[model samples]
Target: MADGPTINTIAERAGVSIASVSRVLNGLPTRQETVRKVMAAADELGYVRNAVARSLKSRRTHQVAFAMADVGNPAYLAMLREIQPVLKAAGYRLVLHSTDAVAADEIDVLHSLGERYVDGLIMSPLRVTEAHLRMLATARAPVVIIGSVPEGTRVDNVRADSRTGVRLAVDHLYALGRRRIAMINGPLDTVPGAARGAAYREALHDLGLPYDESLVQIGDFYRPEGARAVAALLDRVPDVDALMCANDLIALGALDVLRAAGKRVPEDVAVVGMDDTDLAAASWPSLTSVSLGSAERGKAAAELLLERLRGDAGEPRVVTVPPRLAVRASTAGPDYDRRQSGYDGEGGGK
Candidate 1:
């Protein structure tokens, strides 16, 4: 194979020294005439800058790392899609790291900061721990968190208002005359699970509905776990008219269980989930869900990291993305009966 064009050839064509070409390619300060010459030469030679050498010289790889709890989750994939475009627009590449919701793996990424492999990091840890806090306290590069950190922590954070998301689901269920509402939620230790559980209780109190311990079941944030939780929930509260799940995966499990038990969706029981993931739409009776703004939150976290990389400000920022209720076929069945009662619609009225 023929050898590719070199910096020397580019410099000769541009009538400038190799050093000037290097400066321009590395985005370092250079004279205007030199920059113009380098660009013209690069265009003529069809030369691409050697990223490896440039990274070595400047100590910046022009890449950002994104560490997530669950790479397989559609919500996380949605966030990745949003984050990739924004980072690409800013002339940076992405490095994805799936931590499997493991604290050790997350901390490993943070420690990798000293290697200077990436300019910044955006992490979404499922659970915050002391080790996570310690890593953030002295992180080598700019770090933006997509989940909740400590209240007074000095870091940029973008969080979904999951509390509001849960409330939206509960309130929607109540409006549908679902007084016997049961919750099949994830474990209470995780950030989202804890926040959503608290919001469920608060929303019931606000709606003047009694909080029944018998109607709640805890599961891990997986389909099988959700199915088991629903099984337990139904065994105890057979009259439950509505089910609120902490996430789409759990809701899907609940749907499977309900169907297996010969129950009709929305007619016998209305089901709602959080996150508004693609699975919610693809289910047999498409699930109504609360949007936690996962994609928007990812974009915000990326923007915050970019701003820090550009040295825009010194203060830590907190961004909260609002949640919205997405109504679909699962919660739009005939049992609601509002349309027959002169309620003026099949859709849930505001």
Candidate 2:
């Protein structure tokens, strides 16, 4: 095996000082003669730049961290799928951190910015606490928060308006003439959970439908818990004509229990989920969903962090990805009252 070439070897071959060779190799402005000599020397020795040495000099790891609540959630995975490619294309490696929706764990991720292991970070905390605000105020590296932050918070932020998303789902249900609409939501303390809950009631009022307590079910954002919550909601509100779920997972769970109870989707109760994950289209009755632009948010967040890393000294920016309703078999089937609707089943365009 042959030994690899080094800067010192190039300096020796080029008959130049190490400093001159370093400046020329690092692309610092130098005399044309020095560039010619260095290029000739590098070509002869087949020299390749050392990334570790370059990073040490430039203080850039070319890596980015993305922290989310869950690794397996389809919504976060959609973001991950988009984020991975965008970072990769920009010559940055992605470091994944899952906080499991724990506030302390999320805070730990926020504090880890001091270590400076990566060039930047993109995080979606379930709940942004006072500690989060403190850490973000003095983050060691640039951060692109993928959730809501306070106004004037100096960080690149991308947030989803789940309230608008929930309203879209409810409006679609109302357009289909499904007045007895129910909601299956996650815990209300979380940002998305609370926004979705409030939006459902507001939507009901807008549609002139009474908001019934029996029609709302509280559950964690997972299959088992969603199923349990839907089962209970069904037991209490057996005549529910439609459902607006906080996320696709809960809506899928609603399908499971509704099928067991012998209610046909869209025919008996049209179901709508939020996040518009891939699972939405794959369900038995393809689930109608609210597209919160997960992919767009991820791509935008990566771009923002990369811009910051590139020495853009402007104040932090914010990108709000709009929501759209995606109608499918679950809400646009034979049972729907087409005569009374404004929109067809195919949700809105991208």
Best by TM-score: 1
Cα distance off (Å), candidate 2, residue 73:
0.8
> Judged by lDDT against the true structure, how good is candidate 2?
0.83
**For model 2, how does the per-residue alpha-carbon lDDT over 1-350 read when each residue is reduced to its tens digit?**
16777778888999998898776665555554675687668667766345323433456656788999999999999999899998899898898888899989888777756534566899998787788899999888889999888788888999998888998888888888988999899999887888889999998898888988888899989988999999998888899998899999999999999899999988898999999999988887788899999999999998898898888999878899999998888998743333234445577322
Runs with alpha carbons beyond 4 Å of true place in candidate 2: 1-58, 334-350
lDDT of each: 0.85, 0.83
- Residue 229 alpha-carbon offset, candidate 1, angstroms: 1.2
The best candidate by lDDT is 1
lDDT of the structure predicted as candidate 1? 0.85
Q: Could you tell me which 10 consecutive residues in candidate 1 have the lowest summed lDDT?
A: 48-57
lDDT of 1 at 136: 97
Q: Write the per-residue lDDT of candidate 1 for residues 1-350, one digit (tens) a residue.
A: 05766778888999999998786666655554675677667767766345423444465667888999889989999899999999999998898999989999999999867545578999999899999999999998999999888899999999998988888889888898899888888878889888989999999999999999998899988889899999988888889899999999999999999999999898899999989998887776778999999999989999999999998777899999999999887898743344434455645553
